[model samples]
Target chain A: MTITITAFERSPDGGQGLARDTRVRWALEEVGQPYEVRLVSFTAMKEPAHLALHPFGQIPTFEEGDLALFETGAIVFHIAQRHAGLLPDDANARARAITWMFAALSTVEPPILELGSARFLESDKSWSAQRMPLVKDRVRDRLTQLSARLGDADWLDGPFSAGDLMMVSVLLRLKASGLLDEYPNLSAYVARGEARPAYKRAFEAQLAVNKPPAG
Target chain B: MTITITAFERSPDGGQGLARDTRVRWALEEVGQPYEVRLVSFTAMKEPAHLALHPFGQIPTFEEGDLALFETGAIVFHIAQRHAGLLPDDANARARAITWMFAALSTVEPPILELGSARFLESDKSWSAQRMPLVKDRVRDRLTQLSARLGDADWLDGPFSAGDLMMVSVLLRLKASGLLDEYPNLSAYVARGEARPAYKRAFEAQLAVNKPPAG
Candidate 1:
């Protein structure tokens, strides 16, 4: 069955590969699975058709034959579970890796997202400047713990897995904020993830869509 | 192998079942699995010993024999995968159910958590009053979509899978805020989850720990 997934017609990030479709693409690349992308405009995303697939009205919904799934974590995990390279063979190791995946999304990403909402959604608000530090500090607290745990390690656990993939993707949001730079190991960790051949391919794929056409 | 999971020695919620451990316990109960709970103090959660088991330094870490896991979503998922009842037998249905679990934690819960942090962490800030509407609106937006999707359905997808388990848990946080009441269907949805025998057992177990002794 041919795997089909969705992406933003024009990403809000303008091809930074920060959009979640990049994560799904990266997962597919890591597993050496060929897939197709269906672009959905922001308006189309909220339409009944897209909402049927993703109640949240987000991109990167996966479809293979009768299976339809959403949420980048779930999409990535589904891909990882069916494929060999994204998860470990050992059951215990695989469970730990999945734990990291949840930690990345549930524990770590929430604060980072709060920071984004402060910067973008509420940029014009009266309290934006004053409240920025509190939001950033919240993110810093999480990063501090993550950095400590990641001390002198290559990937989160052992070899690269979906956990690292999700964590790196979550941390990448903080690159512009410079909070990730404060933790050198985490910065290096993100760099290593970016250095992966699969990541590069995925990045380029999303970049191609967002790149401006020549006049 | 006997399964052991950790919980907060004294839950900050006073045993309302808002703690992530409740979610894990509920999953175990749904699958008819008996598990042991080990309590961890807040200070110990941050210490290296507990951090080794849970890098993020939160409660609800699962240990069985030599294998240990953290993150409630992952722990619940592990139980659901190994045991019956929490997940569907159909591969596609199972994937969709897991998708709801991710949706619960990643999409719905993030905004709710922000509202929590705003109310609890930033309550003293000058901007709390002004900024709260924005945070609340963010949650309302997600719930509106969720309520729409859930219209007249007992569960998000099908017969009381982990998807409903997670979505219900996430929605329960909003009960105190009164936001959940705005959507009658969602409020009913959560009530339905609470009405389940497994959920009741899980709730009572946590309540027992947090309940004060009678005079």
Candidate 2:
């Protein structure tokens, strides 16, 4: 079955690959799966059609035959579970890798997202400046623990799995914030993820769509 | 192998079942798995020993023999995959179920958590009052879409899978805010979840630990 996934016709990040479609693309690339992208404009995303697929009205919904799935974590996990490259063969190791995926999304990403909201959504608010540090510090606390646990390791657990993929993607959001730089190991970790051939391919794919046409 | 999980020594919610451990316990109960709980103090949660099991230093953590896992989504998923009751048998349906789990933790819960942080962590800030409406509106936006999707359905997808288990758990946090009541179907959905025998058992178990003793 041909897999069809959605992406932003013009990403808010302007081809930075921070938009969630990049995560789904990266997972497909890692697994060497050939898929098609159906780009949706921001307005179209909120329409009844898109909302039917993703109740959240977000990009990056996955469809293969009768199966329709949304949420990047689920999409990535679906790709990973069916493919060989993204998960370990050992049951325990696979479970741990999945744990990292949850940790990346649930525990780590929430504060980073809060920081983002402060910078973007609440930028004009009176409390934006005052609340920024508290938000960043919460992110820093999580990164500090993550950095300590990483402790000079390359990937989060064993060889690169969906966990590392998800974690690296989550940390990439902090790249502009410079908070990721505070932890050198994590910075290097992100760099290593970026260095992956699959990641490069995925980044280029999303970049091609969101990049502006040359003058 | 005995399945053991960790919980807060004294839950901040005072056993309201808002803690992530309650989600895990509910999953276990659905699967008819008897597990042991080890309560950890806040200090210990941040310490090295506990951090070894869970890099994020929050519970609940699942341990069985040599395998250990954290992040409630992953733990519940691990139980669902190994056990019979919490997931559907069909592959596509199962994927959709997992998608709901991801939706609960990633998309739905982030704003709820932000509302929590604003209320608890930033309560003293000058902008707390001003900023709260914005946070609550964000949550309402999600709930509005979610309520629309749910319509008259009893669950997000089908018959009481892990997705409903998780979505209900995430929505349970909104009960105190009364945001859930704004969406009658969502309120009823949570009521259905709480009414489950498994959920009831899980709630009481956590309540037993965190409930204050009678004089």
Candidate 3:
């Protein structure tokens, strides 16, 4: 069955590859799966058709034959489960890898997202400047623990798996914030993820769609 | 091998069952698995010993023989996969069920957690009063979409799978905020989850541990 997924018609990040479709794309690339992308405009995303695919009206819904999935973590995990490269063969190792995937989305990403809201959504508010530090500190606290755990490790656990894929994608959001730089090991860790051939392919794929017309 | 999980020595919710451990316990109960709980104080959670089991330094962690796992989503999922009951037998349905689990933790829970931060962590801030509406509205936006998707359905998807288990757990957090009541179907959905025999057992178990000493 041909796998089909959705991507933002024009990503808000303007091709930085922070959009979630990049994560799915990276997973597919890692697994050597070729898939098709359907672009959805911001307006159309809220329309009945797209909403049917993703109730939350988000981009990056996955469809393979009769199976449809929306959450990025799920999409990546599904791809990982179907393919060999993304998960370990050992039962315990695979469970630990999946744990890292949850940790990335559930524990680590929330604070970074709060920082995004403070900078973009609430920037014009009277208290934005005053509250920025608190939001950033919360992100730092999670990163501190993550950095300590990482401790110069190349990937989160044993050889790059979906866990590292998800965690690196989540941490990439903080690249512009410079908070990731505070933990040099994490910064290097993110760099190693970026250095992957699969990641580079995925990044360029999304960038090609979102990049501006040259003069 | 014996299954053991960790919980708070004293839950901040005072046994209302909002803690993530309750989610794990509920999954175990649904699958009819008996497990032991190890309560950890806040200080010990951050110490080296506990951090070895849970890198993020939060409860609960799951341990069985040599295998250990953390992150409630992963732990509950681990139980669901090992035992029958929490997931569907069909492959597509199981994938969709896992998607809901991710949606619960990644999409729905984050805004609710932000509401937690706004109410508890930032309540003393100068901007608390003025900024709360934004936080509340963000949560409402997600709930509105969720309510629309749920419609008259008893669960988010077919049957009462892990997806419902997780979505219900995520929505339970909003009960105190009064946001859940805005959508009757969602409110009913959560009530249905709470009404489950497994849920009741899990809730009572946590309550027993966290309940204050009687006079």
Candidate 4:
């Protein structure tokens, strides 16, 4: 079924692919499944219409025919499950890959998200500086173990799967913070995910929406 | 295969069933699956051995023979996938249930966890009071929509699946804040989750570990 997903009318990151729709778009592209995008404004997000699709009022809700899905991890997980390229065939390895997806979002991403919340929503707070390092450290500590486990390997576990898709997505948020550069292997890992033709297609798709209007 | 899961030797919450392991334990109980728990002290948790199981230095790692998984969501998902009753049979409903799991962790849980971090880790800061309300409002916003969607329903979708298990676990974190009471439906919903025999069993099990040593 051809899918239609929502995106931030304009991502705060200026088309850097922080909008999770990039991951969904990338997954669709990887499986060579064409889809449509529905850009949502901030005002529209708080309304019941958008909340119906995403209870949290977030972007990148996926809909196709009778099925509607929210939560980027779940959407991407569904995409990976339905599509061929995003998951592996081996049962155990596939489970491990799925574990990585959870690890990326549940473990690694939480602190990074905390950092973002501190910077944007709590920047005026006097403790931003003090609190930020602790948050960053938590992210780095997780990254350190992850990087060590990864070593010089290209992907997280075996081959490219939804795990890598998610891990790379989590790491990208740290790029602006300069913390990701601390781990060369992770930087290269992010690079490999970006280099994927599918990732490129997805990035371009999100960029198209968030890119500045014509001169 | 029999599974062995790691839990806090002494849960910080004194096990009022707030530990992540409680969710896993409840899932096991719900599935009528007997499992083992391996308690790890804080020191052991940070050591290399435990770190291998959980990079974030946390408890509730699941091991079923050769298979090892971290992240409560992944472990719970694995259990639900392998066993019956934790997931819906209908494909669309199953997808939506899984989506709620992601929504619980990525969207709803993050802010709640942040509120925890802010209280425990950053409470000394002067701006904590100022930042807390903003963070709380974000959480309330999510709960309002979730409660609206749930509305007098017994469970999230059709049945008592892993989605409600996850959503309830996330909401439990906010129970003490009285923010949950603001949405009476959500407060009642959490009570429903707690009232489950599986949940009671899980909570009591964790509480045993949380209680202080014999005097």
lDDT of 2 by residue, B1-215 (tens): 89999999999998899988999999999999999999999999999899999888899999999999988999999999999998999999999999999999999999999999988988998998988889999999999999999999988888889999999999999988988889999999999999999999999999999988999
TM-score of 1: 0.99
Ranking by lDDT: 3, 1, 2, 4
Q: Clashing residue pairs, candidate 1?
A: none
Estimate candidate 2's alpha-carbon lDDT, on a 0 to 1 scale. 0.94
Tell me candidate 2's interface RMSD.
0.6
lDDT of 4 by residue, A74-102 (tens): 99999899879988998778888998998
Error of 4 at A113 (Å): 1.1
lDDT of 4 by residue, B60-89 (tens): 999987888888999999999999989998
Worst 10 residues of 2 chain B by lDDT: B151-160
Q: Considering only N, C-alpha and C atoms within 3 Å, which residue pairs clash in candidate 2?
A: none
Chain B superposition TM-score per model: 0.99, 0.99, 0.99, 0.96
**What's the CA RMSD of model 2 in angstroms?**
0.8
Residue lDDT tens for model 2, A63-148: 99999999999999999999999999999999999999999999999999898989999999887787788899999999999999
DockQ score, prediction 1: 0.93
Candidate 2: segments with Cα more than 4 A from true spot: none
lDDT of 3 by residue, A1-215 (tens): 99999999999999999999999999999999999999999999999999999999998999998888999999999999999999999999999999999999999999999999999999999999999999999999999999999997789897999999999999999999999879999999999999999999999999999988899
Instruction: Quote the lDDT for A40 in model 1.
Output: 98
